[model samples]
Target: MIELKDVYKTLDGRKILQGLNLHIREGETYVIIGRSGTGKSVTLKNIIGLMKPDSGEVNIMGQCINNMGKEESYALRQKMGVLFQSGALINWLNVEENVALPLVEHQRHLSKSEVQSIVQHKLELVELEHAGKRMPSELSGGMKKRAGLARAIVGNPKIILYDEPTSGLDPVMSNQINDLIISMQEKLGVTSICVTHDMSSAYRIANRIGMIYEGQIIEEGTADQIKNSQNPIVKQFISGSTVGPLTQ
Candidate 1:
């Protein structure tokens, strides 16, 4: 569903992506794990067209996003949902309104009832059914993330990109978020690209896992295969060791 081929990007005189290549199959969860400043977020930005690579191609759903018309780019983005690391909810809006914002902005053909129906379904999927009337300040961190997820899926997007879905939550809440991500995949069958450092979350949610290093993917495999990888960098990373090749 998505392919980044020989992608190279530089920001602020620093090369962030160098010959980065990735292929995400449709209807599968692909998790990317890497250290800080390893181009995980940069890769996502390239895919979303927030930043174009200095060189190489980003193709989504068989179309090159690197060279698309305004209307075309906008249309392509509408098919994808993104859950930012911070949830990025509107502080002024209630949960229901936040969830309905996408439909309100796009899909103008839908009536109030239709929008409400979709919002309700998405909120329920995120397990925030009764919190619709609550404000952002009234929610816990997990609730905020869930609400953000509800807003993301309200439009029934074909792909979901999660940035640190399990970050800053207690173990229980983190597991809940992980399960919710898995639920979204199973229930909606959407292609998922999750970028996280949490190994537990990555192992649980990913059908395929890739590790990025020096701005490119150095390893890609199934969860177990990644867990059992022999590469020194991959071994040091997954083991959380400080004295291996990564640290050396």
Candidate 2:
């Protein structure tokens, strides 16, 4: 449902993505794993049109995002949701209001009752039915992530992009988040693309995994394939070894 072809992006004369290419199929959980500064998040931004590549094409569901008009871009974006690394929740807004913000902003025609119904359902899906009145500051890290997740799916998006969804959480909480991601995929059938360096999380949630290195996708396969990959860079990364091609 998403494709990035021959993509190249640079920032301040530093190339972050060089001829990067990736494809994510429909109804599948695709995870992109890489060390810091390897363009995993950059690739996600390119997909969502938050950042355009200096050169190359980013296509979502057959339309080139880089070439879309304002209305077209808005329509396209309505089909996608993003859960950022930090949850990106507005501290002042309560969980219910935060989850309803997308509907309030993009779907203004809906009545307050309708919006509340949608928000309530999303919160329930995330198992935070009683946290609606709570503020972001009042929630635990896991709860914050769940709140962010509720906001993301409140729009009923066809695609979900997760940026480090399990970051900073304990092992148990991380596993819970991973389970939630898988649940969303199975229950909603949304195409998912997760950008993270957490190998365990990736292995838990991804139907397919792509290893990115030096701004290009060097390996793409199932978890078992990735584990058995012979590429030195991939091995070094997945094995968490320091004595390989990847320099410290």
Candidate 3:
């Protein structure tokens, strides 16, 4: 559903992505693993149309987004949802209003009843139906993430981008978030691209995995293939080793 071909991008004279190539299929959860500053966020930005590569193409849902006009780009981005690491909930709005913000902004044609119906369904999907009346400060870390997920899917987006979905949560809550990511794939049939440093969460949620190094994807495969990979960089990162190619 998405492809980045021979993409090269530089920011402020520093090359962040160099000849980076990636492909993700429909209805699959693809996880990207790498050390910090390895262009994971850069790749996500390119996919979301926030940043354009100086060279190479970003294809999403059949359109070459690199060349789209302003209106076209805005329309295209409506099909995407991003769950940032912080959950990014609005501090002022209650959970329900936060979840309904997308519809309020982009889908203003809908009636109040329709908006409420969508908000309610999304809350239930994320298992936060009863918490809709609560404020962001009132929620626990995991609850906030689930509410954010609800907001992301409220518009029924085709692709969901997860940025450290389990960050700042305990293991039990992390597992819950992982399960929700898997469930989103199975139930909503949406393409997912997740970038995270948590190997355990990556193993749990990814149908396929790729490891990025020095701007390009050095390895790509199924979760098991990635787990069993013999590449020194992959092994060292996954093992949490102190001494390896990455450290050197």
In model 2, residue pairs whose N, Cα or C atoms come closer than 3 Å (at least 3 residues apart or on different chains), thus clashing, are none
**TM-score versus the correct structure, for each prediction:** 0.99, 0.98, 0.99
In the range 118-215, model 3's lDDT, one tens digit per residue, is 99999999999999999999999999999999999999999999999998999999999999999999899999999999999999999999999999
lDDT tens readout by residue for model 1, 54-159 = 9999999999998888899999999999999989999999999999999999989999999999999999999999999999999999999999999989988999
- Order of candidates by lDDT, top first? 3, 1, 2
Cα RMSD, model 2: 0.9
Give, for candidate 1, the lowest lDDT window spanning 10 residues.
Answer: 44-53
State each model's C-alpha RMSD to the native: 0.7, 0.9, 0.6
Best by lDDT: 3
How close to the true structure is residue 173 of candidate 1, measured as C-alpha lDDT?
Answer: 97
Show pairs that collide, candidate 3.
none
Displacement of residue 46 (Cα, Å) in model 3 is 0.3
Predicted candidate 2 versus true structure: per-residue lDDT over 1-248, tens digit per residue: 99999999999888999999998999999999988998988898899888888989999999999878889888999999999998999999999999999999989999999999999989989999999999998999999999999999999999999999999999999999999999999999999999988899999999999988899999999999999999999999998898988975
